[model samples]
Target: MEPKPATPLLNKETPIIQSKPNKKDFLNHLEAYLAKRDGVDKLLKISRYAAKIVLTSSALPETLTLTHRLMSFESSVGVSRKAFRLGKFVQDVNALRSSHFDSTEDVFLSIVAYGGEGVYFFVEQFVWLVKSGLIDKKHARRLGLMSAWAEFVGYLGSVSLKMRDLNRIKEEEKRVKMSIEVAITRGIKCEEEKERLGKLIEKKLMKRFSVVQDLADALMAVADIRDGKGHFLGPLSVSIAGLLSALISTHKNWVSC
Candidate 1:
């Protein structure tokens, strides 16, 4: 046999490793981290708080409606009228906290044991209501029809099923988050997930939100002008609605949530 060719002392290597960001992998890792931080486990306490606040506020909006309907019912006896009107609504408000207890999220169970900041809750009340099939499916379907983001989450895994269906929720949540990030980077326009074999989890589960789509559009504009995440340029038409809004809203809710 001919003598083996002499091997080069050093292997030729490419600097492609440093070429550009592997956004896919980078984002995957980021998603995993955010999921952990935003998880049912780490944020159960926050989730319950968020659930309570949202539930109460949502019901609070119906005060006038409750008063009108009750007067029509003629059950205004011994009812302080205003207080009575608000009382029933208050009870309904409590349902917000009561609904979130003993829930779960895919691999984890909620910390809330029964309608509170307990040890068995994970998802929120509205989500729980949706999960327990206690809400109006038709209304939810209507909400879904408002936008594609709304549709996928309607009458299905939404907040309603997210309690018992943990894995599906996480996968869906991640996809929406990523897509929102995409919209944020795309020429200043608003924007807009899944899974089977863990691989498919990235496809079938995520459901984008209309609110997020609007935010992404704004973020994209910001990035375009500044060439970065939070920078800005020109007259900066940005307001308390886009990234600023998301930041403020999440900040307010997160602290309280």
Candidate 2:
């Protein structure tokens, strides 16, 4: 029989004594902690409130002729005007909230769900009206060609869908960063277009507006512990309390206003 080599002490296979916690379990625990502090509820409330405000402000911009016409019809309907408007607003809000919360990136959903979807809905109506000859060719041209409206809606839909998954959001951020880098190196040929894209990237692509800043702060503490830094529960508690304080202050300010 061939002689078997003895295993070196240093190189011997030692089973892992402990494995990392499941990610979903980790998230559930975090969510429970946050829920105790009312963090998750506040995120949902703020998202809906913010969406209502944005939807009203953007749904009837000067460029949307079709939406204006619809509003005119609603007004002419007399007794049903207020009810019609309220019903529509509620419907939009429900749809927006469903889509928004389904996404991992709540911040992006906060803005885009209300603002982007409002615009997209009008664009769809406008294109339909134009194609059906209900809108004059000259008026349609003034508002914007159907092709342009369709393209804009498509862009908004694509972005909204992409926000649903965290991996997709991160991938999109990488792609946007690369495009901007290429633009800088190659030099944008159209100054106007470059400025427009820059603003879109700044305002829509890069911005994250949400009430979860404290949760993120708590996460930093978790990261520090994972990195072998001494654990400090005080920081995490303070972060959670700070968000609650902020919410109270905001409510007071709004009431005063």
Candidate 3:
């Protein structure tokens, strides 16, 4: 018999969602992931059989403030696994816990819908609505936007970043710029789509003498702002938003493919 062909199981498409060795110590982190999706019971069932993981206990405190935060982050839907990995949602509870609350969620949502995304950031604006001196810590959870939308947006953000990164290292010439533009304009869903976008952009912008990586960077920031909102416990409005201000002119330096 011919030797069996090697498996492609190690391919990058398959990301290993590892369970922390001490999950109990990181229940907050697990909760952040779980609260972002719909159907907890099903996810629980899935986790049970995925490489020696333990089911989470439901005995967490139910403060109304945090409850509201979780509700805000969660949607009535979930993202499909079939969707591409946007950015890797590293469940870094430590980052969240330790990162001083210097910024608001506005920094994440201004590019998409400004009002709701912005309002979520500034707690000072809501001081009158609360009793007194009660800071809400429930802002860490998030739910998807209408089934798989969260994952899709995340994938888009990550891909956009990759394209911007690729664009910075090329020269301004017909063919050279063409190739770089081609590689940078690819879609966010998968490798095939990214490659396809790259080719199309190259064909269109081959003669482009000027390119603005800053504008491209700003455009990428748009996705981060929009999708970052979904990472919150619920959909929110932001305050004090920043401009996606990138001034790209015809005279700027562009790359050649």
Candidate 4:
């Protein structure tokens, strides 16, 4: 038609070349990952419990020497991770100072959770010092017991708070669903509202995973509080719980990173 624009001189289409990640990109990503304190701590935690699991498993051969090495590695990692928490309790205090709650129950639970955690972390420094051989080992058991109890209380408060928040989220989700149904029934165009509600629901669902992590940590705390002498919780059970907690924490940290 109409002389076809005088014929193109050359092909105008350009080839698309996909760039792959190189060694420099990988090193940059690894550096970013290790830069976050929580990310590194969670990785170490995962490694520690994974080692414990392998050490306790019967399927491994020459486990005596392996177990000893694993135990040493695990212990060292545990102590090192505590060093990351030197001023961690200040975060809890700051949170408490900055937050405003809707009810007295929320305030009480927040205090219990954050306060208990603060105490636990504060006590943990001494325990860490003991483990590091700066303090006498004789105080280790008492300090450790206190830390475990505080951690258990913190977890209890955390679980309660999360349950309350979950209930509220569920109620909100129900309201949103009903609204969506009504809107659809009335032939209303609310695509933006529906999308917002969907994202809210997704966020709430992701938050529910934290409860599982908390429960697993609570189990480990119970084991620590009892010095691993509980009937239902043996070395294997504790190791499994620790691993579960570590994996959940690692997932959270990785996603945030």
Candidate 5:
């Protein structure tokens, strides 16, 4: 009995091994799970809505042209072919979203600043000005406004056609409408501030163009134009440019911090 007890493996240590999952296998499982939850479709739908809102709010000619192209392409193709094209379109829009996010360095800011009605109007006008050969793109691009606007247009124009997406557009419009008013109010305060802004606009921006009153009137018009449903792009553009320029000029020193 003592000899049998001595044979017991008392010194033996058992190692606990953990199972390691391969990254590719994990991804495959995750994708399968997402497919089961309809997450991919939902995400794509949301993307479509986001893209539509950005495009509609910005109202850039290039974006509009792209939208028309997509529409024409859809109308011209068969159902199966259209689905393929739409997938490609979504990919292109997502790429644009990535580029825009890269430029802003923040998704929230990119969506808000570029997607908001105020900035949209500004970019739309700027693009128009650029297209008409009225304003130089160099300064605007150097200011980083052009890049933001470009991404906004590109992403928005890539949106697919869906009924729910249209409803989302309306919701987005409301959000943009409220945001613009709030931002403008916050940006420019009392009469002194307004007057100061006006003077600066006249000095810096107006000096370059013959359409001083158009610009000034547009700047003032944003205060009264409350609805996103209305045709306020012309005026909204001036307001945004003024606000953005003032903000940049005032806060440019923050970069050193």
Candidate 6:
């Protein structure tokens, strides 16, 4: 028999070159972001507050015109954002309808929060109309005051609910930690359980961040209800609070996107 031919050497595997994201990909991402009501609203909120922050800054007299333009832009964006929120509170109402709460207090808080938010959003439409000149400006102040009070009530309920939930999460975390410690002490191989507990802890930590967001929003609501009159909530202070709240909301929307 003829000697077997030597096997040919195999070619090295080719490296996969990932093409950089192009303008088309960027446009796709932009479309996705703009498609989301919350995403667009949050972006507008950030722009509005950022403009307000700049407008409130001490600047040369020559820059006054620019600041005035920024103020107009901020106001316009604010009204536009309200349009995005036209039916937003319906989400909360639906959540209340679908959710199963642990206690009567939870139920009550959810109802109050969702109900108040629903009212606020409904009233906000008229306020937006007034500001946009579609409705009489005489109704602006009344609608604004109503919306503010409704928002304040909603925030109060939301803050209370988040605090309660956070407390419960803390207790659960302690129990999980204790269980983990016991397992480790007993030389038990509970890798899966430990991993599960770790994931649970991470989720709880995210909820904590949500609590911070709600608190920031609550502060802004307080400023609105107070009409930004107090020293602690003057124009600059309100702008800063709004910026903080807008940043938090934008982060949340970005992550969700």
Q: Each candidate: what lDDT?
A: 0.34, 0.42, 0.31, 0.79, 0.38, 0.74
Query: Residue by residue across 101-191, what tens digits does model 1's lDDT show?
Result: 4434511222121222211122223333443467665554333223222222222222333334445557665665455445444534432
Candidate 1: C-alpha lDDT: 0.34
What would the per-residue lDDT of candidate 5 be over residues 1-257, giving only the tens digit for each residue?
45433222212241112223245565665555455323333333334433444444556566457877644443333122213222233433443366533333345443443354234434445444454457786654432354344434433332211122344445554554444345444553334333433344333332233133223323333423432235544434534443443333223222111
TM per candidate: 0.16, 0.24, 0.17, 0.84, 0.19, 0.82
Query: Ten residues in a row with the worst lDDT in model 3?
Result: 237-246
Q: Return the top candidate by TM-score.
A: 4
Each prediction's RMSD to truth? 21.4, 24.0, 19.8, 11.2, 26.7, 12.0
Order of all candidates by TM-score, from best down to worst? 4, 6, 2, 5, 3, 1
lDDT of 6 by residue, 1-100 (tens): 9976543221133121222323556667778878988888888888998887777766535356886787779888988988887777778778879978
Worst 10 residues of 5 by lDDT: 8-17
Q: Judged by lDDT against the true structure, how good is candidate 5?
A: 0.38
Model 6 ranges with Cα > 4 A deviation:
1-31, 59-64
The list of candidate 5 runs beyond 4 A from truth reads: 1-26, 62-64, 70-257
Poorest stretch of ten by lDDT in candidate 4: 9-18
Number of the top-ranking candidate, with lDDT as the measure: 4
The reply for model 4, stretches above 4 Å from the true place, is 1-32, 61-64
156-203: candidate 3 lDDT, tens digit per residue: 433443344345333222344344335444422244433443454553
Point out the higher-scoring one by lDDT: 2 or 5: 2
Task: Please give the TM-score that candidate 3 achieves against the real structure.
Answer: 0.17
lDDT of 2 at 217: 34
Query: Alpha carbon lDDT of residue 58, candidate 4?
Result: 60
Q: In model 2, which regions exceed 4 Å deviation?
A: 1-92, 99-105, 145-164, 168-257
